[model samples]
Target: MTTSPRRPMMISAGVMAVMAVVSLGGLVFDDRILLGAPIWLKPFKFALSIGIYFLTWGWLSSLLTVRQRLVARVSAVVIGLLGVEYAILITQVIRGRASHFNVSTTFDRLLYLIMGGSIAVIWTGTLVLTVLLFHTPIADTASRLAIRWGALISLIGIGLGGLMLVPTSQQRASAVHQVIGAHSVGVPDGGPVMAVTGWSTTGGDLRIPHFAGMHALQVLPLLAMLLGFLARRFPRLRPDRTRGRLTAIATAAYAGLVALVTWQAERGQPFIHPDGLTLSAFGLLAAATLGAATLVIARGPAGTTVPEPARHTEMAR
Candidate 1:
C-alpha cells in the first residue's frame, strides 16, 4: 500500500472511532458513575471528539509542504498522548473516582501527573503544527487565511482549558477539593446540569468558549469554502475579493461572539439568563456583524475588482 501524509491521521481516527463505540457500549453495559456522569460517557465523548479532530487535522496537515513525515510523527505523538489520557480517565472511572483533581491517593496523584504531562505535550504539538500551517503557502487566499485563523482560535480555546486548572475560584471550592472544580461559577460543580454537556447551566461554565473556539478550525474553513461556492453561483460577486472579505468579517464576528460569551461566563451569568445589558451587547454585535456582511456581499461587479487570487496548487500526497 502507498504511504501518505493523511494515513497516520486516518489510522488514528479509525482507532478512536472504535474506542468511541466501546465506550458507548460500556455506558449501557457497565452501569457506573463517577463525578456525576456515567463513567463511560466521558470517554465516549472524548473518543468521538478525538476521532473528528484527527480527521480534520490530517486534512489540514496534508495541505502543507513537507507534511508527510513531520505530520506523521506529530500525529503519532498526539494519538499516543490522547490514548494515555483516555486510559487514565477510564481507569479512574472504573475505580469510581474522578479522573481530574484527584489527589486522594498516591496512585491517583501519579495518574494525574501522567495525564497532565501528556496533555501538555499534546498542546505543544498542536501549537507547532498550527505554526507550520500558518507559514505554508496556499494560493487560495481565503482558505489559507481561514486555516491559519482557525488554528489560532483553536489554540486560544486550548489555553482557556489550561485556565480551568489554575485553582482560582473553582466552583464549590472547599477542603476536599483535590484541585479546582472545572465547572460552575456562581454555584457548585455537580448542582444543575445542562442536557448535552451536563455542565451547570445556571452558572458560569468555561466550556462555552472552549467549545466554540476549538471548532473554529472546522467552522471557519467550511464557511470560507461555502462562500467560494456561493460566489460561483452569483457572478456579481465573482472577483473573489468579495467572498474573501465576507469570510473575514464572518470570522471576526465568530471570534467576537466567543469572546463575548466567555466574558459573560466569567461574570457568573447564566447563558440562558441574559440581562437587558447583555441582550443589548449581543444586539449591538449582531447589528455590526450584519452590517459589515451586507457591505461586503452587496457589492456588485461595478465595485473595484481585485486581481483574482492564484488558483490553489493541490499538495501532492
Candidate 2:
C-alpha cells in the first residue's frame, strides 16, 4: 500500500490547531462584537472545528488509494482556501465587525464575497475528492460505507449552510438594517441564544441542522466500525452482514435526526422546545428504524448449501 502523503496534512493540522488556540487567547484580550457574539469567538470556534475536520478526514482519506497527485492538489487547494477563510474571519474579528452575513459597508461586502468564494473553492475540492474516493477500491465494506456516506452527508451539511446564506424576509431586513444573510430564519441571527453555539432560543436558527449534518462524516463511519468490532467479538455473528445492516440503520437514524432538526428550526422552534408534532415525527422514525433493524437481524446472512460432488458418484453407483 502506498504510504499516504500524511506529512503535509499533519503540518496543516498542527498550524490550524495552533491558530485555534491563539484565537481563543485573542478572545480574552479583544472585546468586539460581530452580531451579538464576540468577533473572535466565531472565528475561534470555526478554526477549532475545521481544523479537527481536516485532520480527521486526512486520516480517513489515507485509507484509500487515490492518485497521489490528485490527493496532493485537492488537499493543498482546500487547505489553502480554508486558511484564507480563516484569515478573512479573523480579519473581521480584529476589525470589530461581522465576517459572514455582512453587507453593511462596501469593504465588508467585498470581504463576504472573498469568504464566500473561498468556501466555494473548498467545497468544490471536497466534492472532487468524494468523486475520486468512490472510484477507489476501499478495502472493507464498512470503510466504503463510511467514505461514501460521509462525503454525501457532509455535503448535505454544506448545503444547509448554503441555505443559510440566502436572504430570507427577516434576513433581508437585517441585511438592510445591519448584516446580510443572517443564519436565523424567523428572527435575526443575534437573537436570544441558548448560551452555547449561539443558536437562537427565541426563533429559528438554521445552524442547528447544518451543525448536525456536518459531523456525519465522523459519526457514521465510527458507528459502522464499532458495530463491526462488536460483531467480531460475537463468535456466532457474521461481521460483514451485521456491519452493513447496522450502518444502514445508523445512516437512516442520522438522516432522520438531521431532517428533524431542520424541520424544528423551520417552524421557529428551539432545539429544546420541540412540540407534540416533533415528538410524534421522531417516534415514527424510531419505530420504522427499529422495525427494519429487527427484520435484518432476524434474517441474518443467507446460508447456501453447496451441492456435494459425491451426489453424482452416488447416483451413478
Candidate 3:
C-alpha cells in the first residue's frame, strides 16, 4: 500500500507544534523548566523529539514503493531507538547518576551494545535510502540534490556525535577552574576556590561540538540549495560537469574544515579544553566521503537509462 506525500509534512508540523507548547508550558510553570523535569523524563522528551523528526522522514519515505517503504520504516525504527538511547544517557548525566561506564553491568552493556548497533544500522539504512531516492523520479534536480546532500550532512553529524562517546583522559590542569579563578566569579576564603561544577565533570560540554558538527547538515545543504537557485540565472552553469565537480570540492573542503575544528576542540587542556572537536572531525570526514561519492555520481555521462520503478499499486497525487 502507498502513503500520502503530505503525511510527512503534516507529522512534522504537528510534532513541532507540540514541542513548542511543551516548552512554553514549562517556561510558564517553572523558573527552572529545563531542570524541573524528572531525570528519566528528560531523555524521553529528547527521544520523542528525535523520533518525530525521523518519523517524518519515514513518512516521506512511504511515498516510495513497498520495498522502499520497508527500508524507510526499518531505518526510522533504528533512528528512533538511537534517539531514545541518547535521551536516556543524557538524562542520566543531567541527574548526576551516570558513571564512566554506565554500561558496566551485563544488562547495561547489552543495552549499550543494542543502542550502538542501532546507531550503525540507522546510519547505513539512511545512506541506502539516499541512494535509492537519488534514482527515483523527482520533480526537480535541485530538490534531488538537496535531499542527497541533506542526507550526506546528516550522516556527518551522526558520525561526530558518535565519536564524542569515546573516552579521553582529562588534562591535568582544569580550564574551568582557571577561568573562574581569574575572573573572580566568586571566591570562598583564601584564594579563588575552584567551584565544583557538575556538568563539567560529566560529558555535557561535549554536546556543543557534536551539535556544531551536526548543524552543518542543515547549514551547508541550505547553502547549496541557495547556490542551485542562483545558478538558474546562469543557464550555462546549470546541470554541468564543472558545477558538479565544484560542488564536490566545496563539500569536501567544508568537511575538512570541520575536522580541523574538531581536532582543536579535542586537544584543549582542562576545562579550557576544546570539546566536540573529535566528533566534528568525524562528521567532516563522513561529509567528505559523501561529497566524493556525489562527484562520482555527477560525472557520469548524461542520458543514462533510468532504473525501473518498483511496483506501486497507486502513486500519490
Candidate 4:
C-alpha cells in the first residue's frame, strides 16, 4: 500500500474536529434539553467519537503495510469492541433502559464485560502495534535494540493496566458518574468533593482503577522515547535520532504528573476512595512504577537492532 504522510494527519484532524464539536455541543446544552435528551443519544456521541478514532486507524493502516498492518489489526480489534458497545447501548435505548449503567443485573454485568474486555484488547493491541510501527528505520544495531527494549517496557505498562481490570465492580457506578457530574475516584483534595453517593449498585470504585491503568499510555510511550534518545546519543546507537529523547523526557514528566494526581486522589480519601485507600494506593504504586520504568528505559543500554520490513514486504513477495 502507498503510505501517504498527509492521510494520517488528516484523519487525526477529522477525529479531533468531531470530538471538539461534540464537546462543544455538550457544553452548550449543559443541563438543558440536550443534556437531558434521550439517554441513548448520549452514548451515541461517545460511540461516534470512538468510531472516528477507529476510522483514523483504518486509514493509517491502509497507508503502509507490515508495521502498519499490525496497527490495522489492533485497530480492528478496538473497532470491533466499540461496535459491540454501540450495539449494547442501542439495545438499552430500545428497551428504555438507557439510564442503567450499573452491572447489578445480568444484562448490566454482560455489558460491563463487553466494555472492559474490548478496552483490554485495544490496550494490548495498541502496544504491539506501537513496537512494530516505531522502530528506527535508519540506525545502528544498538538503536534497534533500544527500540525493542522500549517496546518491552511499554508492554509491561499494558500488562499492569490489564491487572487493574481484575477488580471491576464499579463499572456501572462509573457509567452513572459519566451521566451525572460526579468526581472521579482518587482525585486530589481541593475542589468540591463529589461522591457516587447513589449509584445503581454499591461495589468497588471502577473509575480509579481504569484511570490508573490508562496512565500507561504516557508511561509506555515515554519509555519508547527514552530508548530512541539513548540510541541517538550513544555513538554505538543510531545516528539520526529525531524526537526520541525529547519525547521520552516529556512522557516521563507526564507520568510523574499522573502519579501526583493519583497521590492526590489517595489523600482526598473518602471522596475519591470508592474502593478505599488500599486500592487507591495500589493505583498510585502502579503509576509510580510506570514513571520509574520510563526513567530506567531512558537510561538503559541500547540493545539489538531489528530490520524494518521493506515496503514491498507489506504487499507481496
RMSD list, candidates in order: 3.1, 7.7, 10.3, 9.7
Cα lDDT tens digits for candidate 3, 212-232: 455554555455556455545
Residue 102, candidate 2: how far off, in angstroms? 0.7
**Global local distance difference test of model 3:** 0.47
Ranking by lDDT: 1, 2, 3, 4
Off by over 4 Å in 4: 1-71, 87-101, 134-244, 266-317
Per-residue accuracy of model 4 over 59-135 as CA lDDT, tens digit each: 33443345554555555565556567666755665454532334556776677667667766766675665555454
Candidate 2 local lDDT, residue 94: 77
Q: Which is the better candidate, 3 or 4, if ranked by lDDT?
A: 3
Model 2, range 1-317, lDDT digits (tens) per residue? 43454566777788888987888888887776666876677877787778777876677567546687777787888878888888888887778877887888999999999988988888888888778778876545555676578778887887788877877775455425446566776776776777648788778788899989888888877766565555544532344555566677778788899999999988878887789999999999999888988787677754422234311111011
- In model 2, which regions exceed 4 Å deviation? 1-5, 31-33, 170-178, 301-317
Superior candidate under lDDT, 2 versus 4 = 2
Local distance difference test, each candidate: 0.75, 0.74, 0.47, 0.44
Please give the TM-score that candidate 3 achieves against the real structure.
Answer: 0.53
Clash pairs (backbone) in predicted model 2: none
Best by lDDT: 1
Instruction: Please give the lDDT score for candidate 4.
Output: 0.44
Q: Which ten residues in a row have the lowest lDDT in candidate 4?
A: 308-317
Ten-residue stretch with the least lDDT total in model 2: 308-317
TM-score of each: 0.89, 0.87, 0.53, 0.46
Better of 3 and 4 by TM-score: 3
Error of 1 at 197 (Å): 2.0
By the lDDT metric, which is better: model 1 or model 4? Answer: 1
